[model samples]
Target chain A: MSKSVRKKPAAPKKPVAPRKPAAGKKPVAAKKAAAVKAAGMAKQPDIAPLLTVSDIHTYYGDSHVLQGVSLDVKPGECVALLGRNGAGKTTTLRSIVSLTPVRRGHVGFDGLDITHSPTHRIIREGIGYVPEDRGIFSSLSVREHLDIALWAAKKPPERRDEVLKIFPRISERLEHFGQQLSGGEQQMLSIARALLAEPRLLILDEPSEGLAPIIVDEVRDTLARVKKTGTSILLVEQNVAMALALADRVVVLSQGMVQFTGTPAELEAQPDVKDTYLGIA
Target chain B: MTFFLFNLLNGLQLSMLIFLMAIGLTVIFGLMDILNLAHGAFYMAGAYFGYVVFQATGSFWIALAIAPLLPLVLGFLLQYFVLQPLIDRGRSAHLDMALLTFGLLFFTIGLIDLVFFETLGLTFMSIDKPAGLGSYVNIGTFYPSYRLFIIAVGLLVALIVWLLLERTVVGAVVRAGVDDREMVRAMGVNVYVVFASVFALGCGLAGLAGVIAGAELSINITMGVQILIPTLVVVVLGGLGSVKGCFFGSLIVGMTETLSQAYVPALALFATYLILAAMLVFRPQGFFGRTPKSV
Candidate 1:
């Protein structure tokens, strides 16, 4: 009970104070993390990853998937996880959310060991998830979805307007149910729903999947706007170009293992890793 | 026409009673995806609990008030402690839990029979209709006041529930949980708590329905078993997870069953199934259910 009530629902969606390093960890790791993050994002505090997933092994039935996956997202930085079909990209996001429990490894978030935490508790720690499918309830109206998101986040109702401004298209369809929305509209609602929670870390599985090129560009621009608000994002995408364009750091995965971690420019320089793993030259 | 009115009122009474039972079942299944076969047991236990309360207090009102608590708490404990653990351990074993509840259904039947029939040497019991409600009242012609009360209460509950689910933020949370349990949890809502609360509410309604129905029919060990299939039919006819569907489903099944028993005695037993069959053949999702979820 104390697990949730201890933290007030995050303040209205603004760039709150930069996250401090989690307590009781070696200051060396925090300093090293800060040094690595300093190269990209200047605004982040000298802290360990706002989100740290270390050596997680997840399995789907007997199939050995996500063999020792690890990654980090610094405060306000967007990390793109690049992988092919069946590369366990979505599973990694699900693992962090604890939707898919990791068999072995640590998922530390905001200073808490959350690998075993229930999905809701992990989310309550200020990580909002936009699942791969855009997870819209066909029977519920657009307003209800937004209301539910606000309620879950424990945010005031006034934030609805502020959140809706991110995706103006959804505002007009407030009365429309989930099934009534077009795919782009659904994607917008999905992001808007997560944003309503005012998370410190936002995990989107595939914001661009099944979307047209124009809509993908629209999504990228909207995400860029969200990035300005200082929310760390972990994006899993098959759209290499979108991922490369938005990411500060890219982690390439192949056959459930981390194959490379570098800047987009570094990844582009090494065509072997990019072409062999991501099918890009 | 007077005779038709009498049957219509009777059908409504049954429909209203079953509506209470069906809504509980539908909502529980809708949110948790748990087809609780023991819902009928909760209905029977409610009557037995009400019988105890009514016997001691000699007040129907008191019995109605207290009886639902037994099943409500029991349902919460069952979902939170037993069923949830099983579900967590074996996500693939949902049907096994259904069968386990099937066992629980009969276990409750035997237990009810033991306490009420075997040990107490009772064959059947019925609650007395409250004063002023026993006598007939003028509707179109003279109608049993209690039956009319049941219909009124049922309609009132339906309206209240519809408003609660459609208009409130709490209901939105629940409906969202129903639509996408994973996403709801991902949003930081404690879905297990929601599941337990819904399960408790459903069982509580069953208990309330039991006490209401007790006045109309004798409570026997087999009473819960008897209503199980009809209510299941109501749930399916309405849709798997739809409250609106439950309303229309209960009405349609109640009317046909009551009218058939009066007008064509031989078809009474199969009347509910006939509607279920038609709904299955034409719209497998029932009246308002989503495309019947394969998951």
Candidate 2:
């Protein structure tokens, strides 16, 4: 039933490589040797991506928004996904969390295939998402918002105090309704709420989208503190400088595919790619 | 003066009954965006359940205790089997759900009619007021003690509902859900379960109202349909989702209904409609309704 909803095409057949005479005959021993090699590969820091999205195709109704898009976030590292408007950056983050489910390809999280897992399951498996619009409940107070997330994550009550220490402005406006807060305060509350879940990976969509420059600096400082805690982050942002400043590596998306993936310095060296893909000179 | 006082008391009692009916309607509509036309069927089922329990147990208290449970269970079943599937089809399925529930309403009414009136040969059913509530109490004119008890129960239930929404974690989730369902789900809560539980709660309240109304007015198969229009008016007048609005809307409706019926018998039925039309013209969002924010 689930498969019917996905509309998957036939699985691609692997191309056979020229091999030694012993390779195809002794299948069991070959599988064992390959398993050993894979395990050995996992020990390498670059090989074991914490969150790997490989060639995921996603859609919004009939509109094919993300066409075979893929990226990776390594353990305890921050990777910013940068793109122009409608470049599928937000859809990439959404697909990882299965909010907009992938029609093809796999999403491996913490060494498990979670490509078809439900949104809540993805969240429970320690991925916190902060949506672009903030998604705050107008009727809920700041305290209630954090408390609900903590309750969902089954965190201790003291987690609230710890989160407050990180975002003191939220603490100051704890009793105020979510709609009452300014854009920066709401963003802080959103990030703080996601942090309380104690997720291994936090996915933030446009956290500095509409905030003032000073507020963006506060958010940057907060992200730096969060990075020090060793939680992997997948950030989707349009602010080129902010993305470059915080990201250890950057993935630039264009027309629903990965245009470039490298260190910020590597991206900085190529102004033509930036201008052509990101509309940045 | 005595006549005016009598009408006022009568209106107040009617208002409490309307509140019980409207409270559930507003919550279910608010949280799920489902316009359940079959809500009145639950009310009718409650009255019938109360009748059966009262007949078999020979106790009003026992009947009252068990009547609402039946509707709660029925609500869960309906939510799981019927409403859940429609909801999964997305926002466009709202009209389809309303039509489905409308069909459910008629089915329930038909089933009850066949079982009670056709099979059992009982034309109409009514439960006696509980022992202590049977007598009359004087407030310038004689009023039934059961009516006063209902008013008290209504106020108490309102307070309890208010507290539940304001002070509990479940209430916070519910309120958050009313504002943003996707956000609640992203927070790792199964919003479907929350929606089902809330739908059941609303259904139970409707049932309780039915059981109470059974004793006040005679229970007939057509009673659900008869009261559904007025109840919907109360819900809209109270601003669709606001409990406080339901309370005051019920009062205004009840008063208009009773006073207009008492003085100008010909316009009695139209009085509530007149007020509703006036509200639509002057304050389209209703008294307490805020304009919904686009997501």
Top-TM-score structure, candidate number: 1
**DockQ of each candidate, alpha-carbon based:** 0.46, 0.44
Share of reference contacts found in each model:
0.71, 0.58
Report the lDDT tens digits of candidate 2 across residue range A1-281.
Answer: 00011111334222222112223322211111112122212323243566777778898999999987766776677888888999999899888888787888778876667888777888987899999998888778988898789878899999889879888889999899988999999999899988888888899999998999999999988998898787888999988898889987677788887777666765777687688888988
Q: State the number of backbone clashes in model 2.
A: 0
In Å, residue B239's CA in model 1 sits off its true spot by 0.7
> Candidate 1, what DockQ?
0.46
CAPRI classification of candidate 2: acceptable
Candidate 1, residues B167-257, lDDT tens digits: the string is: 9987887777777788888878888888898899889989999898887788888888888888989888888768899999899988999
Assess every candidate by TM-score. 0.92, 0.90
Off by over 4 Å in 2: A1-47
Error of 2 at A123 (Å): 1.3
Best-matching candidate per DockQ = 1
lDDT of 2 by residue, B65-168 (tens): 99999998899888877787667656436688789899999999999989999999997789999988999988888988998988887888888888888888
| Candidate 1 off by > 4 Å | A1-18, A21-46, B91-94, B292-295
lDDT of the candidates, in the order given? 0.83, 0.81
lDDT of 2 at A136: 83
The docking category that best describes candidate 1 is acceptable
Q: TM-score for candidate 2, please give it.
A: 0.90
Query: Looking at model 1 chain B, which ten-residue stretch has the lowest summed lDDT?
Result: B286-295
Model number with the top lDDT? 1
